[model samples]
Target chain A: MTFARILQVFKKEMIELRRDKWARFRLVIPPIIQILVFGYAATFEVFGVSTAVLDLDHTQESRDLVSRFVYSDRFQIVKIARNQQEIVDGIDDSDAAIAIVIHPGFAQLLRKGQTAPVQVIVDGTNSNTALIALGYMNEIAATFSRDYMTDHLQRTRDGPPLRGALVTLEQRPWYNSGLNSRWFFVPGVIGTLVLTMIVNLTSFAIVREREVGTLEQIMVTPIQPVEFILGKTFPFFLIGLGEVVLIAGVGTLWFGIPFVGNPLVLLLGTSLFLLSTLAIGLLISTLCMTQQQAFATNFFVVNPLFTLSGFSFPITSMPTVLQWLSYLNPLRYYLVIIRATFLKGVGLSVLWPDMLALAAIGSTLLAVSILRFRKSLD
Target chain B: MSAPDKPKIRVAGLTKRFVGTTAVEGATFDIARGEIFGLVGPDGAGKTTVMRMLAGVMRPDAGSIEIDDVDVVADPEQAKLHLSYMPQRFGLYEDLTVDENIRFYADLFEVPRKLRDERTGPLLAASNMEAFRRRLAGQLSGGMKQKLGLICSLIHTPQVLLLDEPTTGVDPVSRRDFWRILYSLRESGVTILISTAYLDEAERCTRLALFHEGRLRYCDTPKRLKALMPGTLLAITSTAARDLHKALLGRDGVMSVMLVGDGVHAVVDDADRRVPELSAALDAGKIPHGELVRVTPSIEDLFVGLLKDEHAS
Candidate 1:
């Protein structure tokens, strides 16, 4: 309520911010790098996957099967291993992300008009990418089986089906036709960068004061608790908001991504999300005493939050429990809002529930931070 | 409480507890207007805890603090207007320049723009920081930083100033300069309460309160505290000062013998009477000796004796 005191606090924060070039850099660079790292490097479109094959049959049929996988552009045959031990060694050494085994009986079974099973193994450590790689492998194998069956049936006096020889499914992707990994990633990158920068920066503010023995200095003044918390939080709040704008602009103009949501609604969502993160950061500051502790704790919490934020994988396809867990994650909400606004063109009416949830989380976090901060000081 | 118009600050039965440990137990003290009172003790003696409670940064487990007759517990905000506290580290914003820090504090205390120019000039001059006004506080030396901290604490010009070891690591010259500023503030009728571990700094205070194990051992003027020494203190220097120190441990008329630096200082009862026996013992040991003049007991010596006496009882 004391505008003068709040203004004083605001001035103090800005002065401190302007002095440390690194902290300011951290505030900006973290988000920018996160946008690029998460946007470009992170993807569901698995390519150049190191795959090996054990082809026991040296017939044309077996060679044709191998050619099908090579032609799919998904897997690169890294090696043709001699036996299962070599395949196991390849997987263990991470030299290959997938392995396919074709038995010697494969060609003979095809000539005898019998189906033969081909075994495929994929590393499931990074389960999301592994799953995508598995899907690509299945598509290749299915096409090879269809081609062999059609050739064999013609020789057995069966003609092509009445519904034309074959029908190729035509895919038309809306908004992002190329499904550019950059387009899908940039918005989430913005969300994550803001999340880490705002949370880490604000989280250390109060703890740094405590470590340097300055909290007592500020507390002895006539400033109220709410005023102090808000004063310290606003600059970071604005920075987080600014980061979203900067990243969105960069993502759109430089990266060729589209922005279709109502600007006002988008800003409102971002503001709530940033407010939530700032509160969480402030709450962490109250719990930690030293700068190192604050840093460690922030990183520990942020790692999983970013991983499970639906930026890396689709939440809808995850197991029901994990999907439900995403409901409690603010990153999930923010990611949804960002992707919707930037890619889907959805507005307030469709996204009101997410906005409300963000607001609730932000308010709760702020209240909890203020309470803990007061208790710690007392 | 003393008389109705006794002092500008009064604390009665102030206690502070941390988890299972009691930091300050029933700490009672008073500081008159325009006086420099110090809480003298080593670390963990609850000096900082007491100051924090008085500053309203912390709440007491039990007791009352009154600043210029305002109840600190009932209304801490109003009470804060009458006091300014600089914590141990002085809380300098390293990134901000010297002048910016001062202005920031001034703004927090709501000093008007017109009055800000009038007050900041002398403060900066007193701190000898006028030339470095544009320099970041992080670039200042240890002493200048302390001076700037003092200036920042004084920006509001509160009636009472609470300092928690403002000169702990500062050099002697800067410590002296800091005390000079405090003296001027005292002359201007501000009540100053400071906590310090340095005995020499405690000697300059108008009054000193000795604290140990969360209890006050003694509180009086420096003169009166030295007068509280029940017997004479003699400085003893010899070739075998350590051996002689051990020999005088349980001897009659020997109050205490403590090693201070290279020499041992012995507190004896009637130094004139004990000198002959001390000499005879030295003769048996065949150790050359230096002067054994009777000297005033220092604040360190006084507190050590008090703690020993309390242990004996």
Candidate 2:
């Protein structure tokens, strides 16, 4: 456990990494590419949803209502349908994801001061996209109805004195006023990419030597198990830290996602998260005998760490059993820390508990790995 | 016995077992300081198991190992400070250059920079590998790889060196060069334990331990091992060598018969009488042959003879 021995190992690892072309490619190329792709692709907001407009009431009022969907910037009316058959054809052909239908008595019903119902039909092929598009349609229709009601009341000034001044609600969204999903996704990429690179690298560290028959060579030296493990994993820890900075800076500056929290808080949270993830890799390294076995085990291990961590799917939405399992996944806690830091601008006052959980998991995993590592050496 | 006073390596009742099989059972031996000890046997004879236990890379299931006053089983790390082991087919990092591999190992052993430079310079030159230092370890020939492995193990100048079949696949020329480097290391008083499949290599060791089927069948000098043969050996070279082999089996005065390359080697009670009798038999079979020549038993001849004896009883 001496520092000198550990530093020697650290130096060797760095030199090896510097020379390994694939390793260098993984460190530099993939993080940038992943951030570029995942930041934009992993979005909950769906725009340009092709819609078919079927306006039976071909009046100025019907035309004006159809314009609302177009102006929402979320839909494109690719087809002007004459009837239900045309709308059906558009949706069946996959040409339109949704259709806005106005009945023939739509304007007459509004003129009579009664309710006018607009039927919205959606394609459910990709349920997530369908669900998000449906939400956007609801918002657009609500705003149009509110405006039309106000205008109708002004034209009929004698209408029962209008109870309670027509109940107008003003909504204010905090932190992200326009609610950009990239603001949420870009910061999470920092955690995901760091987890992926550091875990995969560290997990293969000892196993590669074992497969190539160098581990026995190392074990025959005076280097202790703890010293070797620290030396092996610390280099990846530094790389993961550098990546967090690179991604956080890129997300905030390049992608225009705001970073409103204390950098020190973000740094602390990230280091703790890196500690646990690197320990997880070391544990995997001890359990595996070969690089291929390590890779297979990593597939099972990392896939769960990614999916179960509320990266794309919310843990609260999962079953109670899975939600409980997510508690053990360090990524779940790190996600809360990273998302809160990027979006909410909160610090340790809000994130101390998750930080503490990370410390506990990291230390426990590291201790176990060191114990198993020493045993495996013999 | 040539250790002068105290032995550098001692073992008592060393044993290791895998599930449903024993790898080494109650093995006991001592290696003196500065002795070039050979672990000799055919493949799967537990030679490697014995070498691994001595190197402290593996723990004996039921024995004690004391190396330089250190209990290797209970305290392998301490024992490691005194020994360097080159396992069978030692794998150097292919991506690293030869110099980088050496420097990396030197650092692990905490070799001082000045001392490392002094030693590495001559070691590479001695092995004629000084020019290849910058080359990646993967790019080197198999023999060069084994040489580099040996060099890396020696950077620490350990008290004991363990080499497991370092020349198993190397060319004869490289193997000669390899033995030269080992002889020099022995001159420096580094006690070495080398396990080899080639019986000729066993003759070069100051002492040899013959392992067979997980047991040490014989432990002594190569000279003494050949002295253990039951009778004089005769070499019968013939064109019909395979037939000559069958003809010599189960004959009186003949203790054992083995078909060697283009010849048959047999141990007999009396070489003179057996030669005449064997010549008569070969003549009856019309097997054209050369004159029967009496030769000293080689380590291989002795190993084959011992293995035959073990199978008999």
Candidate 3:
């Protein structure tokens, strides 16, 4: 309503934020630390899985297979098993994550142009790690067998066995040619971190006043409800935007993630995302009566935003019911826009749908929060 | 839009309920311009509820509240321009300095810098808080925090000020200083309605309203209300005061008996005659007793008497 009143509240809040040591710490230090921490910690690509090898063949072919595992930089051989019992001990003791067993006839089978049977055992404790390890093992074995077969065909002058299987396919991944997981996660850290910071900042800012009894003090004044609400949320919106810039800077400069899309589109997406998160924070503030309650509710609300927003997991892999629910998550759309813009270098033509989704969700949330804000002014 | 003859704040039949229980019922009062009206009651007497409704912060379920002849329930915003309310715990941003806190409230009320500074200087000096202007509110003494709350509330030069238990937990010295500032504000013609749990503060108010269990028991000048007390109150002390309460109940000369902090306060029909009669009776019962003194009737004395009267009838 009145710009002067709203501006005053905004200025007061900014001053408080600046002077509050704990709030300042939460805003400045954690985002940088979290971006650096999560960029490295939240990756999906598996490397250097501890492995045990039981080579009974004692032949060049068996050694070549073991060398492939080493050269691939995927499996680190922690123990060369003398017997079957040792391989079992390595896996059971958690000293090794996976074990490879090459039979005694492996070299004879390969020389006679027959299939080589390789037995692999894995620790299934962390199912995700086990699965990725299996995938890496499969690729390395396929390459080893394909190279061996081509050599055999050149020496013996015989037709290729498993013709289609030995077809040398060269895989070139686009956009993140290295398929680096940091490239994916760093861009997303900007979203998750910003969401967390903005929500906590906005929610705590209002609920702390209610707890401290300032909310009622302000309500008794001549200030309009709209002006108060605008004043309360705008600071957080700017803080959220500033956070995006902070994390994006760290993401590009420190983590070496590329920023390829138009800055305007990123800014637009950040604005919409901030609006929705800040609305969510305000709504939570209205429901709570104390800072402790606000903290718990923010955790309760933001946890789902992270998990269901496809920040770490794929939305398509979720159950149909949850997939439908993801449509309501603002972070879900923002993550898509962030990852797309950062890696694919796509523009509005490909991102308008997500942008529309974000706008719809953000405006809807903001309207409800404002309505609730007005109602709770008493 | 106020007529010269009208009261500054007129609240009629104000009632409010929360969930299924009534917090304030059929409360009616008026505050004249420049008057210090004290709403005195014990905890849960609905004093704060009445102050909240008058401040336009809490909407009464059924009532009309007019501040400066402006309808409050229907047009709270318009009425609020002339109103300032201080809650039981005046919520100051503790991270902010005292000066910053005052400026924030002034900005909220849209007070011009020239006027705010002019008023703040005198008010701060009167409350003796000028030295601590730059201190964070969280770091101030409890007494000074209350003074700052008053300063912030008065920054706008509002016509009506509503303070709910502003000095409930403050020290005696600070409370005296607070009352001195309030008396000065009355000179400027600002009608103040303050809710307090302290009955002794009634002596400082131009008028007082007594509340008990969501109802206004008495509303008038403190002098007039004290005159309405039915009987003389006798302060009887013995080796065991609880025993005195039981022995005096339903006695011939005593109307009712109550325990007041390790002593018995007996409302007797006539203190002159009842004092000797009670002394003789205590001797007969072998209860060790002291000389009886007739204590002046206060708002609390009348409240205890009114509660007894209600229970008897």
C-alpha TM-scores of all predictions: 0.93, 0.88, 0.94
Clashes of 2: 0
- Per TM-score, the best of the predicted structures is 3
Q: Please compute DockQ, using alpha carbons, for every candidate against the native two-chain complex.
A: 0.72, 0.64, 0.79
Better of 1 and 3 by DockQ: 3
If both were scored by lDDT, which would come out higher, candidate 1 or candidate 3? 3
Most DockQ-accurate candidate: 3
Better of 2 and 3 by DockQ: 3
lDDT of 2 by residue, A162-182 (tens): 532555568787988887778
Candidate 1 residues lying further than 4 Å off, grouped into runs, are A51-55, A78-101, A119-130, A158-181, A316-325, B1-4, B285-288
In order, the Cα lDDT scores of the candidates are 0.84, 0.87, 0.88
- Candidate 2 lDDT for residue B144: 92
Writing each residue's lDDT as its tens digit, candidate 3 over A25-60 gives 778898999988987798887889999999999999
lDDT of 3 by residue, B116-155 (tens): 9999999899889999999999999888999999999999
List clashing residue pairs in candidate 1: none
| Candidate 3 regions with alpha-carbon error over 4 angstroms | A21-24, A56-64, A103-116, A147-165, B1-5
For model 2 the local lDDT of residue A263 reads 82
